[model samples]
Target: MGAISVKSKHLLGLKGMDRQDIADILDRAAYWERQPKVSDALRGKFVANTFFENSTRTRFSFEMAEKRLGAEVLNFSAAESSVQKGESIYDTMRTLESIGIDAAVIRLKPTGVLEELAGKLNVALVNAGDGNNEHPTQALLDLYTMRKHFGEIKGLTVSIIGDIKHSRVARSNLWGLTAMGANVAFCAPDTMQAPELEHYAPFVTMDEALQADIVMMLRVQLERHDKGLIRSAEDYREQYGLTAERAARMKPHAIIMHPAPVNRGVEIDDELVECGRSKIFTQMEHGVPIRMAVIERVLTS
Candidate 1:
């Protein structure tokens, strides 16, 4: 197996990652995708998947990646551990490190905690998803999918529509894509937009967003919003959803994507999810190799 190199000991977020580093990760992911189902790249290394919040894709993907690379895996769930009885996240991490874990894949509900943990923890830290900060692996998989389909990321117009304020995927994609020379636009209702990102990418109308080469939809994160901020799913769908009509209007070569747990007809039409242009499942398939590349980088870099 080929080695993936990165300067950072921890894969915190993509906010400051250089373009060449992102390209290397994507290229390494492609290599992993084409390899046999398993390898011994990380043989005998101990990695812990520590998730304080609930997850399906990120957790499973990381575990699969770890196993495929022949690493010894420890799965940590907050609810089932001492964390339930008041053990702090830092204490939990330290405990794992004390047990000789070489690296950790963490998903927590709080932002900035990963950065703090990265500083004090001896083991390498990989951010699975932290609050709404960034999910670098997701963005890396996304960039891989885009590149595989389009042959390059440069000059591709990617429109991210829906709940931008609560989407770590969007933030990571924004930072990664822009670094790789893609143009990004945000489209969302006023309450759903992240004003802090105004200087980074313009928030355009839905019609203008459809003109992009890639239309990526985000889940309507009702749990993150104040109750009643979104009056109804129907209301949000009519205004911001990628309905069938909207999908039809997109350019013939344009593709649709969602970092799922899709809300079906809410953020996007149900049928359009598996449509010719949709890369939803393809994105999931890419996650394993993308994460494999990341884990290999962290453990072996």
Candidate 2:
């Protein structure tokens, strides 16, 4: 594995990042994966995990990563914080820094919130997820999982299906995977697809896209569906869900993936979540070391 060299002090997004940087982080993650769980690298440091929106996987994954690195973790809750009384993201971040927090992993409902805070915060800021913008670590762990499976991420066909219009995962994976030379494609219904991404000739049919080496199914984003983007849940499943029929059609070597909090029987078949070819759980398992790499990179550099 290559030596990890990350120049940026904060992990804002994957867009326009050097391919070497991505590889470096993934390499560090691989190293961490083989090491014992507990680490004392950041023993004297303190980090905050602030989530303005609800999350289970990303939140816990980051907490675990921080604790493993021997950093004191401050779990910030939006509902219990001054933010509930109208404190802004900037003030909250600044307050955390004032209290001796070295870095923060933040997730917000607004797209540009993280970027706006990046310039102002004295401490390193990691973007956990910003609205429909991007989730950089998720993409990195995804790359690690792919590399573990195929021995390389380059030259693999990765099809991202469903809710491309509102999926930060799609955006992150699109940029990261393509930067690593993976053939990226998007598949979504007209209402769920981004018009700007039409240049890739996104497959409207699951059959065509499923032929790829990796088939990533995305959640329907029910929160966004309140605006009537989807005609019917049942219809959406029939049209785009990875049913048993579609799952069977995937290449024998092709793997299935979904960033979790999966809408069972919606974006994918429930049975396939643990199917031999499905790397869904493995992806979650990769979250810890991948995030450990990210935390180490941002805090040290």
TM-score against truth, every candidate: 0.98, 0.96
Q: What is the C-alpha lDDT profile of model 1 across 97-174, one tens digit per residue?
A: 998999999999899999999989889999999998999999999999999999999999999998888889999999
Give the 10-residue window scoring lowest on summed lDDT in candidate 1: 222-231
Q: Which stretches of candidate 2 lie over 4 Å from their true place?
A: 1-3, 200-204, 223-225
The global Cα lDDT (0 to 1) of model 2 is: 0.89
Q: What is the C-alpha RMSD, rounded to one decimal, of candidate 1?
A: 1.0
Model 2, TM vs. native: 0.96
Q: Model 2, 1-301: lDDT tens per residue?
A: 3336778899999999978989989889989999898989889999999999988779999999999999999999898899999988888888888989999999999999898898888899898999999999999989999999999998999999999988899999988998899998888887887987677535556778989999999978766567788877777889899999998888989999998878888888788889899999899999999999999998888
Error of 1 at 239 (Å): 0.5
